[model samples]
Target: MRKLFATAFSLWAATAAQAENCQIIGNQTLCDDGVSGQRIGNTTYWNDGSSSQQVGRFTYNSDGTSSQQIGNHTYYSDGTSSQTIGTTTYFSDGRSCRRIGNQISCD
Candidate 1:
């Protein structure tokens, strides 16, 4: 009887630990302590643990596309983003580029 009780307690403890480790919502996993950040669909949400500070949010689209947002800046999956200079076009394979005249070339 004592051995059975010990085994049951151990099993319960292990199950509780696993439950507290991580949580899955939709296609994302959210850590309880916020150390792993929150995932939504194909995107992940991260914060600096500051209410007034800006954080990065990434979203991956189904059509081989993704996006990143930080503060007022928005980045696309093609490695491009909206900058103060102008609209930047990035290659599909993660290469940086800038629009020169009317064409997009690597920067």
Candidate 2:
């Protein structure tokens, strides 16, 4: 499940939407309407309004591979977020490793 979770997180991080200048409005809420992605430096943010909100970042490696990262899942909105150092490394060889907290899985 590590790989799956990491892959999902990475996908969202790469394709999430940001509200141009999305900020905490009305008790930490944002104006994100989901399906839009924004990259402010190394941060990314997305919200589906229905409850799927994500925030993360990704980097394109010099070797043609890539990686997605985030400090932790602190933007779930439901206060049930439980992630630490979510990371997924995509190798140039088509292999990948996903590590969340202390669990590592590859596929």
- lDDT per prediction? 0.31, 0.33
lDDT per residue (tens digit) for residues 1-107 in model 2: 21123234432322221111122222232223323333343333333322222234533422233444445432222222334443654433344445454333444
lDDT of 1: 0.31
User: Which residue pairs show backbone clashes in model 1?
Assistant: none
**How well does each candidate superpose onto the true structure, as a TM-score?**
0.25, 0.21
After the best TM-score superposition of candidate 1, give how far the Cα of residue 58 lies from its true spot, in angstroms. Answer: 1.4
Model 2: worst 10 consecutive residues (lDDT sum):
13-22
CA displacement after TM-score superposition, residue 56 of candidate 1 (Å)? 7.3
